[model samples]
Target: MALPTVPHLSQDGIAFSAVKNRPAYAIASVDSALLLASLLQQEGAMRVTDVAARLGVSVSTAHRLLGMLVYRDFAEQLPDRRYAAGPVLRRGPVQQASVARLREVALPHLRGLVEAVGETANVMVLAGPDVRFVATVESDQVLRVGDRTGRTLPAHLSSGGKAVLATLDDERLAAVVASLDAAVAVRLERELRTVRRRGVAVNDQETEAGLTAVGVAVPPSGGVTGAALSVAAPSARYSRDRLPVWKEALAEAAGGIARDLGDG
Candidate 1:
Protein backbone atom coordinates (compact mmCIF):
# COMPACT_ATOMS: atom_id res chain seq x y z
CA MET A 1 0.00 0.00 0.00
CA ALA A 2 1.10 3.54 -0.69
CA LEU A 3 2.18 5.69 2.24
CA PRO A 4 -0.37 8.33 3.09
CA THR A 5 0.57 11.76 1.74
CA VAL A 6 0.40 14.58 4.29
CA PRO A 7 -1.03 17.74 2.84
CA HIS A 8 0.69 21.12 3.00
CA LEU A 9 -0.67 24.43 1.87
CA SER A 10 1.01 25.09 -1.47
CA GLN A 11 -0.06 26.39 -4.86
CA ASP A 12 -2.52 23.56 -4.95
CA GLY A 13 -2.92 23.69 -1.15
CA ILE A 14 -3.45 19.93 -0.69
CA ALA A 15 -1.87 17.25 -2.91
CA PHE A 16 1.84 16.63 -2.90
CA SER A 17 3.51 18.06 -5.95
CA ALA A 18 6.91 17.09 -7.29
CA VAL A 19 9.78 19.35 -6.41
CA LYS A 20 10.82 21.74 -9.15
CA ASN A 21 13.64 20.73 -11.50
CA ARG A 22 17.14 21.03 -10.13
CA PRO A 23 18.74 24.36 -10.97
CA ALA A 24 21.69 24.32 -13.37
CA TYR A 25 24.15 25.60 -10.72
CA ALA A 26 22.50 23.76 -7.83
CA ILE A 27 24.79 22.86 -4.96
CA ALA A 28 24.39 19.12 -4.49
CA SER A 29 24.69 19.16 -0.70
CA VAL A 30 22.08 21.90 -0.22
CA ASP A 31 19.69 20.08 -2.55
CA SER A 32 20.24 16.87 -0.65
CA ALA A 33 19.65 18.61 2.69
CA LEU A 34 16.36 20.07 1.49
CA LEU A 35 15.19 16.75 0.06
CA LEU A 36 16.17 14.93 3.23
CA ALA A 37 14.23 17.43 5.32
CA SER A 38 11.16 17.00 3.13
CA LEU A 39 11.46 13.21 3.44
CA LEU A 40 11.51 13.31 7.23
CA GLN A 41 8.59 15.68 7.33
CA GLN A 42 6.43 13.61 5.00
CA GLU A 43 7.50 10.05 5.89
CA GLY A 44 7.71 10.30 9.72
CA ALA A 45 10.97 8.48 10.52
CA MET A 46 13.84 6.69 8.82
CA ARG A 47 17.21 5.12 9.47
CA VAL A 48 20.45 6.51 7.99
CA THR A 49 20.52 3.67 5.45
CA ASP A 50 16.99 4.50 4.37
CA VAL A 51 17.96 8.13 3.95
CA ALA A 52 21.01 7.18 1.89
CA ALA A 53 18.99 4.95 -0.41
CA ARG A 54 16.23 7.52 -0.81
CA LEU A 55 18.65 10.33 -1.61
CA GLY A 56 20.89 8.07 -3.73
CA VAL A 57 23.89 9.21 -1.73
CA SER A 58 26.50 7.27 0.18
CA VAL A 59 25.71 6.40 3.79
CA SER A 60 28.47 8.76 4.98
CA THR A 61 27.01 11.65 2.98
CA ALA A 62 23.56 10.95 4.34
CA HIS A 63 24.94 10.85 7.84
CA ARG A 64 26.66 14.18 7.37
CA LEU A 65 23.47 15.72 6.00
CA LEU A 66 21.49 14.29 8.89
CA GLY A 67 23.98 15.81 11.28
CA MET A 68 23.39 19.23 9.75
CA LEU A 69 19.63 18.78 9.98
CA VAL A 70 19.93 17.78 13.61
CA TYR A 71 22.05 20.85 14.30
CA ARG A 72 19.41 23.06 12.70
CA ASP A 73 16.58 21.34 14.59
CA PHE A 74 15.01 19.98 11.40
CA ALA A 75 15.55 16.33 12.31
CA GLU A 76 16.34 14.44 15.49
CA GLN A 77 18.00 11.09 15.98
CA LEU A 78 15.88 8.51 17.73
CA PRO A 79 17.26 6.11 20.34
CA ASP A 80 16.70 3.32 17.85
CA ARG A 81 18.88 5.18 15.28
CA ARG A 82 16.04 6.33 13.10
CA TYR A 83 15.63 10.06 12.52
CA ALA A 84 12.34 11.95 12.67
CA ALA A 85 11.20 15.48 11.97
CA GLY A 86 12.38 17.86 14.69
CA PRO A 87 11.23 21.27 15.87
CA VAL A 88 11.92 23.36 12.76
CA LEU A 89 10.30 21.00 10.29
CA ARG A 90 7.24 20.67 12.48
CA ARG A 91 6.87 24.48 12.63
CA GLY A 92 8.14 25.52 9.24
CA PRO A 93 5.95 27.38 6.78
CA VAL A 94 4.80 25.67 3.57
CA GLN A 95 7.48 27.55 1.53
CA GLN A 96 5.16 28.09 -1.36
CA ALA A 97 3.48 31.09 -2.94
CA SER A 98 0.09 29.67 -2.17
CA VAL A 99 0.73 29.93 1.54
CA ALA A 100 1.24 33.66 1.12
CA ARG A 101 -1.88 33.81 -0.98
CA LEU A 102 -3.77 31.84 1.61
CA ARG A 103 -2.64 34.22 4.32
CA GLU A 104 -3.59 37.26 2.29
CA VAL A 105 -7.00 35.87 1.50
CA ALA A 106 -7.67 34.86 5.07
CA LEU A 107 -6.55 38.11 6.71
CA PRO A 108 -9.75 40.01 6.05
CA HIS A 109 -11.83 37.13 7.30
CA LEU A 110 -9.61 36.83 10.34
CA ARG A 111 -10.02 40.54 11.02
CA GLY A 112 -13.74 40.17 10.65
CA LEU A 113 -13.69 37.27 13.11
CA VAL A 114 -11.81 39.37 15.65
CA GLU A 115 -14.41 42.07 15.29
CA ALA A 116 -17.27 39.62 15.74
CA VAL A 117 -15.79 37.65 18.62
CA GLY A 118 -13.63 40.33 20.26
CA GLU A 119 -10.67 37.99 20.53
CA THR A 120 -7.51 37.20 18.63
CA ALA A 121 -8.00 35.21 15.44
CA ASN A 122 -5.50 32.98 13.71
CA VAL A 123 -4.97 31.01 10.52
CA MET A 124 -3.22 27.70 10.98
CA VAL A 125 -2.07 24.91 8.70
CA LEU A 126 -1.14 21.36 9.57
CA ALA A 127 2.57 20.61 9.30
CA GLY A 128 3.15 16.94 9.92
CA PRO A 129 1.77 16.25 13.43
CA ASP A 130 1.94 19.92 14.37
CA VAL A 131 -0.02 23.00 13.44
CA ARG A 132 1.81 26.18 12.38
CA PHE A 133 0.15 29.51 12.94
CA VAL A 134 0.66 31.38 9.66
CA ALA A 135 -1.25 34.57 10.41
CA THR A 136 -2.89 36.28 13.33
CA VAL A 137 -5.16 39.26 13.93
CA GLU A 138 -5.12 40.42 17.50
CA SER A 139 -8.08 41.80 19.39
CA ASP A 140 -8.07 45.45 20.43
CA GLN A 141 -8.95 44.59 24.01
CA VAL A 142 -6.67 45.52 26.90
CA LEU A 143 -6.12 41.89 27.87
CA ARG A 144 -6.33 39.36 25.06
CA VAL A 145 -4.50 36.51 23.43
CA GLY A 146 -1.50 37.98 21.68
CA ASP A 147 -0.28 37.18 18.19
CA ARG A 148 0.91 33.62 17.67
CA THR A 149 2.05 33.84 14.06
CA GLY A 150 4.94 31.51 13.26
CA ARG A 151 4.41 29.47 16.39
CA THR A 152 3.63 25.77 16.38
CA LEU A 153 1.74 23.58 18.81
CA PRO A 154 0.99 19.90 18.91
CA ALA A 155 -1.87 19.16 16.54
CA HIS A 156 -3.57 16.88 19.06
CA LEU A 157 -3.68 19.70 21.59
CA SER A 158 -4.56 22.85 19.64
CA SER A 159 -8.12 23.78 18.75
CA GLY A 160 -7.25 24.74 15.15
CA GLY A 161 -5.17 21.62 14.78
CA LYS A 162 -7.96 19.39 16.00
CA ALA A 163 -10.36 21.10 13.64
CA VAL A 164 -8.00 20.40 10.75
CA LEU A 165 -7.60 16.78 11.84
CA ALA A 166 -11.35 16.34 11.99
CA THR A 167 -11.47 17.12 8.28
CA LEU A 168 -9.00 14.36 7.42
CA ASP A 169 -10.22 11.11 5.86
CA ASP A 170 -9.94 7.99 7.98
CA GLU A 171 -6.71 6.74 6.46
CA ARG A 172 -4.98 10.07 6.83
CA LEU A 173 -6.29 10.54 10.34
CA ALA A 174 -5.06 7.11 11.38
CA ALA A 175 -1.61 7.79 9.98
CA VAL A 176 -1.33 10.98 12.04
CA VAL A 177 -2.74 9.47 15.23
CA ALA A 178 -0.37 6.52 14.98
CA SER A 179 2.58 8.87 15.41
CA LEU A 180 1.50 10.00 18.88
CA ASP A 181 2.10 8.24 22.20
CA ALA A 182 -0.49 5.60 23.07
CA ALA A 183 -2.11 7.69 25.81
CA VAL A 184 -2.24 10.83 23.70
CA ALA A 185 -3.57 8.88 20.74
CA VAL A 186 -6.45 7.55 22.83
CA ARG A 187 -7.38 10.95 24.17
CA LEU A 188 -6.99 12.62 20.79
CA GLU A 189 -9.22 10.04 19.18
CA ARG A 190 -11.94 10.87 21.68
CA GLU A 191 -11.61 14.62 21.12
CA LEU A 192 -11.63 14.16 17.37
CA ARG A 193 -14.86 12.24 17.62
CA THR A 194 -16.36 15.18 19.46
CA VAL A 195 -14.96 17.55 16.83
CA ARG A 196 -16.60 15.52 14.11
CA ARG A 197 -19.90 15.47 15.92
CA ARG A 198 -20.02 19.16 16.70
CA GLY A 199 -18.36 20.51 13.53
CA VAL A 200 -15.90 22.43 15.73
CA ALA A 201 -13.01 21.89 18.11
CA VAL A 202 -12.13 23.47 21.45
CA ASN A 203 -8.84 23.90 23.25
CA ASP A 204 -9.58 24.83 26.83
CA GLN A 205 -6.01 25.37 27.99
CA GLU A 206 -4.93 22.14 26.34
CA THR A 207 -2.03 23.93 24.63
CA GLU A 208 -1.29 26.62 27.19
CA ALA A 209 -2.19 27.31 30.80
CA GLY A 210 -4.03 30.56 30.11
CA LEU A 211 -5.31 30.29 26.55
CA THR A 212 -8.59 28.93 25.23
CA ALA A 213 -9.58 28.70 21.60
CA VAL A 214 -12.40 27.52 19.37
CA GLY A 215 -11.91 26.55 15.75
CA VAL A 216 -13.58 25.22 12.64
CA ALA A 217 -12.07 23.59 9.59
CA VAL A 218 -11.88 25.67 6.45
CA PRO A 219 -13.89 23.43 4.17
CA PRO A 220 -11.69 21.58 1.71
CA SER A 221 -11.44 22.97 -1.75
CA GLY A 222 -10.85 20.35 -4.46
CA GLY A 223 -11.02 17.62 -1.80
CA VAL A 224 -7.96 18.88 0.05
CA THR A 225 -7.96 19.91 3.73
CA GLY A 226 -5.01 21.34 5.68
CA ALA A 227 -6.11 24.65 7.19
CA ALA A 228 -8.35 25.92 9.99
CA LEU A 229 -9.55 29.25 11.41
CA SER A 230 -9.74 29.98 15.12
CA VAL A 231 -10.62 32.57 17.74
CA ALA A 232 -8.51 32.63 20.88
CA ALA A 233 -8.88 34.47 24.16
CA PRO A 234 -7.42 34.44 27.66
CA SER A 235 -8.80 31.54 29.66
CA ALA A 236 -9.99 33.94 32.33
CA ARG A 237 -12.39 35.40 29.80
CA TYR A 238 -13.46 32.13 28.25
CA SER A 239 -16.82 30.62 29.05
CA ARG A 240 -19.01 27.90 27.65
CA ASP A 241 -21.65 30.57 27.44
CA ARG A 242 -19.59 32.32 24.74
CA LEU A 243 -19.10 29.16 22.64
CA PRO A 244 -22.22 29.58 20.57
CA VAL A 245 -21.22 33.03 19.43
CA TRP A 246 -17.60 32.14 18.90
CA LYS A 247 -18.51 29.03 16.94
CA GLU A 248 -20.77 31.01 14.66
CA ALA A 249 -18.08 33.60 13.97
CA LEU A 250 -15.45 30.92 13.36
CA ALA A 251 -17.75 29.07 10.96
CA GLU A 252 -18.42 32.20 8.96
CA ALA A 253 -14.75 33.13 8.75
CA ALA A 254 -13.83 29.58 7.79
CA GLY A 255 -16.44 29.56 5.05
CA GLY A 256 -15.29 32.87 3.68
CA ILE A 257 -11.69 31.67 3.56
CA ALA A 258 -12.72 28.46 1.82
CA ARG A 259 -14.69 30.34 -0.80
CA ASP A 260 -11.80 32.69 -1.49
CA LEU A 261 -9.35 29.80 -1.80
CA GLY A 262 -11.69 27.91 -4.10
CA ASP A 263 -12.06 30.92 -6.34
CA GLY A 264 -8.30 31.40 -6.43
Candidate 2:
Protein backbone atom coordinates (compact mmCIF):
# COMPACT_ATOMS: atom_id res chain seq x y z
CA MET A 1 0.00 0.00 0.00
CA ALA A 2 1.20 3.54 -0.69
CA LEU A 3 1.92 5.89 2.20
CA PRO A 4 -0.19 9.01 2.47
CA THR A 5 1.22 12.38 1.44
CA VAL A 6 2.09 15.27 3.71
CA PRO A 7 -0.55 17.92 3.22
CA HIS A 8 0.59 21.11 1.47
CA LEU A 9 -1.33 23.31 3.79
CA SER A 10 -0.13 26.86 4.05
CA GLN A 11 -1.22 28.49 7.27
CA ASP A 12 -0.24 31.98 6.12
CA GLY A 13 0.93 31.60 2.58
CA ILE A 14 0.65 35.27 1.71
CA ALA A 15 2.83 36.16 4.65
CA PHE A 16 5.19 33.22 4.92
CA SER A 17 5.58 32.14 1.33
CA ALA A 18 8.93 33.85 0.92
CA VAL A 19 10.45 32.22 3.97
CA LYS A 20 9.05 28.78 3.22
CA ASN A 21 10.57 28.97 -0.21
CA ARG A 22 13.96 29.68 1.31
CA PRO A 23 15.55 26.73 3.06
CA ALA A 24 16.45 27.23 6.72
CA TYR A 25 20.11 27.78 5.85
CA ALA A 26 19.42 29.27 2.44
CA ILE A 27 20.51 25.99 0.91
CA ALA A 28 18.47 24.84 -2.04
CA SER A 29 16.18 21.83 -2.35
CA VAL A 30 13.53 21.60 0.38
CA ASP A 31 11.95 18.52 -1.16
CA SER A 32 13.49 16.29 1.47
CA ALA A 33 12.44 18.36 4.46
CA LEU A 34 8.94 18.49 3.03
CA LEU A 35 9.02 14.78 2.38
CA LEU A 36 10.21 14.05 5.89
CA ALA A 37 7.56 16.33 7.33
CA SER A 38 4.93 14.52 5.28
CA LEU A 39 6.18 11.20 6.48
CA LEU A 40 6.04 12.43 10.04
CA GLN A 41 2.34 13.27 9.71
CA GLN A 42 1.51 9.87 8.19
CA GLU A 43 3.35 7.92 10.86
CA GLY A 44 4.80 8.55 14.29
CA ALA A 45 8.23 7.56 12.95
CA MET A 46 9.88 6.48 9.72
CA ARG A 47 12.94 4.90 8.22
CA VAL A 48 14.80 6.20 5.19
CA THR A 49 13.18 3.67 2.87
CA ASP A 50 9.72 4.55 4.12
CA VAL A 51 10.26 8.13 3.02
CA ALA A 52 12.00 7.14 -0.20
CA ALA A 53 9.06 4.99 -1.31
CA ARG A 54 6.47 7.68 -0.73
CA LEU A 55 8.37 10.58 -2.25
CA GLY A 56 9.44 8.51 -5.25
CA VAL A 57 12.99 9.56 -4.50
CA SER A 58 15.88 7.12 -4.55
CA VAL A 59 16.76 5.44 -1.27
CA SER A 60 20.15 7.09 -1.46
CA THR A 61 18.52 10.49 -1.74
CA ALA A 62 16.34 9.65 1.22
CA HIS A 63 19.40 8.67 3.19
CA ARG A 64 20.99 12.01 2.43
CA LEU A 65 17.81 13.79 3.54
CA LEU A 66 17.67 11.84 6.77
CA GLY A 67 21.26 12.76 7.44
CA MET A 68 20.41 16.41 6.93
CA LEU A 69 17.60 16.01 9.41
CA VAL A 70 20.05 14.56 11.89
CA TYR A 71 22.41 17.48 11.38
CA ARG A 72 19.64 20.01 12.07
CA ASP A 73 17.97 17.97 14.82
CA PHE A 74 14.65 18.34 13.02
CA ALA A 75 14.44 14.58 13.15
CA GLU A 76 16.26 12.14 15.37
CA GLN A 77 17.75 8.81 14.39
CA LEU A 78 17.13 6.13 16.97
CA PRO A 79 19.67 3.36 17.57
CA ASP A 80 18.11 1.69 14.55
CA ARG A 81 18.49 4.97 12.64
CA ARG A 82 14.76 5.39 12.24
CA TYR A 83 13.65 9.03 12.32
CA ALA A 84 11.14 10.90 14.43
CA ALA A 85 10.46 14.60 14.80
CA GLY A 86 13.95 15.83 15.67
CA PRO A 87 12.78 18.09 18.44
CA VAL A 88 10.48 21.03 19.00
CA LEU A 89 9.89 23.10 15.80
CA ARG A 90 8.27 26.23 14.57
CA ARG A 91 5.46 25.03 12.38
CA GLY A 92 2.13 25.92 10.71
CA PRO A 93 3.27 28.83 8.50
CA VAL A 94 6.28 29.97 6.49
CA GLN A 95 5.43 33.13 4.62
CA GLN A 96 6.07 35.23 7.68
CA ALA A 97 9.31 37.15 7.88
CA SER A 98 11.65 35.95 10.59
CA VAL A 99 10.84 38.91 12.77
CA ALA A 100 7.11 38.34 12.48
CA ARG A 101 7.45 34.70 13.42
CA LEU A 102 9.69 35.58 16.34
CA ARG A 103 7.06 37.97 17.63
CA GLU A 104 4.25 35.44 17.26
CA VAL A 105 6.23 32.71 18.94
CA ALA A 106 7.59 34.93 21.71
CA LEU A 107 4.87 37.49 22.49
CA PRO A 108 2.70 35.16 24.53
CA HIS A 109 5.60 34.07 26.70
CA LEU A 110 6.92 37.60 27.05
CA ARG A 111 3.50 38.82 28.18
CA GLY A 112 3.19 36.07 30.73
CA LEU A 113 6.67 36.75 32.07
CA VAL A 114 5.94 40.44 32.34
CA GLU A 115 2.80 39.65 34.28
CA ALA A 116 4.73 37.33 36.56
CA VAL A 117 7.59 39.71 37.25
CA GLY A 118 5.48 42.84 37.10
CA GLU A 119 8.16 44.31 34.82
CA THR A 120 8.93 44.62 31.16
CA ALA A 121 9.75 41.41 29.31
CA ASN A 122 11.52 41.32 25.95
CA VAL A 123 12.45 39.05 23.06
CA MET A 124 15.96 39.78 21.84
CA VAL A 125 17.90 38.26 18.96
CA LEU A 126 21.48 38.72 17.87
CA ALA A 127 21.67 40.88 14.76
CA GLY A 128 25.16 41.11 13.24
CA PRO A 129 26.80 40.68 16.67
CA ASP A 130 24.47 43.17 18.33
CA VAL A 131 21.44 42.28 20.42
CA ARG A 132 18.27 43.82 19.06
CA PHE A 133 15.06 44.15 21.05
CA VAL A 134 12.51 42.91 18.55
CA ALA A 135 9.53 42.65 20.84
CA THR A 136 8.68 43.83 24.35
CA VAL A 137 5.92 43.98 26.97
CA GLU A 138 6.36 46.69 29.55
CA SER A 139 5.94 45.76 33.18
CA ASP A 140 3.04 46.91 35.30
CA GLN A 141 5.49 48.30 37.83
CA VAL A 142 5.92 52.03 38.30
CA LEU A 143 9.58 51.55 37.38
CA ARG A 144 10.99 49.65 34.43
CA VAL A 145 14.41 48.69 33.02
CA GLY A 146 13.95 51.00 30.05
CA ASP A 147 11.73 51.72 27.07
CA ARG A 148 13.41 49.65 24.36
CA THR A 149 10.87 48.36 21.89
CA GLY A 150 13.08 48.30 18.78
CA ARG A 151 16.39 49.44 20.14
CA THR A 152 19.71 47.64 19.64
CA LEU A 153 22.31 47.22 22.36
CA PRO A 154 25.80 45.80 22.50
CA ALA A 155 25.48 42.05 22.89
CA HIS A 156 28.23 42.29 25.52
CA LEU A 157 26.34 44.85 27.56
CA SER A 158 23.01 43.09 27.92
CA SER A 159 21.73 40.06 29.82
CA GLY A 160 20.04 38.54 26.77
CA GLY A 161 23.28 38.75 24.76
CA LYS A 162 25.21 36.97 27.47
CA ALA A 163 22.64 34.21 27.71
CA VAL A 164 22.65 33.60 23.96
CA LEU A 165 26.42 33.82 23.67
CA ALA A 166 26.91 31.40 26.56
CA THR A 167 25.28 28.71 24.45
CA LEU A 168 27.83 29.24 21.67
CA ASP A 169 31.21 27.58 21.56
CA ASP A 170 34.26 29.67 22.37
CA GLU A 171 35.07 30.47 18.76
CA ARG A 172 31.63 31.78 17.86
CA LEU A 173 31.35 33.53 21.21
CA ALA A 174 34.72 35.12 20.70
CA ALA A 175 33.69 36.51 17.30
CA VAL A 176 30.79 38.33 18.91
CA VAL A 177 32.72 39.61 21.92
CA ALA A 178 35.81 40.48 19.88
CA SER A 179 33.86 43.23 18.19
CA LEU A 180 33.85 45.13 21.47
CA ASP A 181 36.69 46.89 23.28
CA ALA A 182 39.14 44.70 25.20
CA ALA A 183 37.75 45.38 28.66
CA VAL A 184 34.18 44.86 27.50
CA ALA A 185 35.09 41.66 25.67
CA VAL A 186 36.94 40.21 28.67
CA ARG A 187 34.13 41.07 31.06
CA LEU A 188 31.54 39.55 28.73
CA GLU A 189 33.50 36.31 28.29
CA ARG A 190 33.81 35.93 32.05
CA GLU A 191 30.12 36.60 32.50
CA LEU A 192 29.21 34.25 29.66
CA ARG A 193 31.11 31.48 31.40
CA THR A 194 29.09 32.14 34.53
CA VAL A 195 25.88 32.14 32.48
CA ARG A 196 26.69 28.75 30.99
CA ARG A 197 27.14 27.40 34.50
CA ARG A 198 24.13 29.09 36.11
CA GLY A 199 21.74 28.71 33.11
CA VAL A 200 20.81 32.38 33.33
CA ALA A 201 22.47 35.75 32.59
CA VAL A 202 22.28 38.75 34.84
CA ASN A 203 23.02 42.39 33.96
CA ASP A 204 23.03 44.05 37.30
CA GLN A 205 24.13 47.60 36.57
CA GLU A 206 26.14 46.19 33.69
CA THR A 207 23.84 47.40 30.93
CA GLU A 208 23.06 50.52 32.89
CA ALA A 209 23.41 51.39 36.52
CA GLY A 210 20.13 51.40 38.46
CA LEU A 211 18.65 48.92 35.97
CA THR A 212 18.72 45.16 36.42
CA ALA A 213 17.77 42.57 33.82
CA VAL A 214 17.73 38.77 33.69
CA GLY A 215 17.47 36.51 30.68
CA VAL A 216 17.98 33.01 29.28
CA ALA A 217 18.73 32.03 25.69
CA VAL A 218 15.96 30.32 23.79
CA PRO A 219 17.76 27.07 22.95
CA PRO A 220 18.10 27.77 19.29
CA SER A 221 16.95 25.62 16.39
CA GLY A 222 18.83 27.07 13.42
CA GLY A 223 19.12 30.87 13.63
CA VAL A 224 15.88 32.83 13.19
CA THR A 225 14.48 31.28 16.34
CA GLY A 226 17.63 32.07 18.30
CA ALA A 227 16.57 34.64 20.87
CA ALA A 228 16.45 35.13 24.63
CA LEU A 229 13.68 35.84 27.11
CA SER A 230 14.46 38.68 29.48
CA VAL A 231 12.88 40.75 32.23
CA ALA A 232 13.88 44.30 33.02
CA ALA A 233 13.30 46.01 36.37
CA PRO A 234 14.34 49.24 37.95
CA SER A 235 17.25 48.97 40.35
CA ALA A 236 14.87 50.19 43.03
CA ARG A 237 12.30 47.41 42.50
CA TYR A 238 15.10 44.91 42.19
CA SER A 239 16.89 46.43 45.21
CA ARG A 240 15.80 43.62 47.44
CA ASP A 241 17.21 41.47 44.63
CA ARG A 242 14.47 39.41 43.09
CA LEU A 243 17.15 37.55 41.15
CA PRO A 244 15.78 34.09 41.75
CA VAL A 245 12.26 34.98 40.65
CA TRP A 246 13.37 36.50 37.36
CA LYS A 247 15.85 33.70 36.71
CA GLU A 248 13.21 31.02 37.07
CA ALA A 249 10.66 33.06 35.18
CA LEU A 250 13.04 33.73 32.27
CA ALA A 251 14.01 30.10 31.97
CA GLU A 252 10.42 28.91 32.09
CA ALA A 253 9.28 31.47 29.57
CA ALA A 254 12.20 30.78 27.24
CA GLY A 255 11.52 27.06 27.45
CA GLY A 256 7.89 27.53 26.55
CA ILE A 257 8.82 29.58 23.51
CA ALA A 258 11.48 27.08 22.55
CA ARG A 259 8.85 24.36 22.52
CA ASP A 260 6.65 26.45 20.27
CA LEU A 261 9.54 26.87 17.81
CA GLY A 262 10.29 23.13 17.82
CA ASP A 263 13.59 23.56 19.63
CA GLY A 264 12.69 21.72 22.81
**Top TM-score: which candidate number?**
1
**Model 2: per-residue lDDT, tens digit, 23-55?**
334433485575465345323467888778856
lDDT of 2: 0.66
Q: Tally clashing residue pairs in candidate 2.
A: 15
**lDDT by residue for model 1 over 100-179, one digit each (tens)?**
56777899999999889888899988877888677788787755665565556888888989999988888989988999
User: Cα deviation in Å at residue 84, candidate 2?
Assistant: 37
Clashing pairs in 1: none
Cα lDDT of model 1 overall? 0.77
Candidate 1 TM-score, true structure as reference: 0.65
Q: Indicate the worst ten consecutive residues by lDDT in candidate 2.
A: 13-22
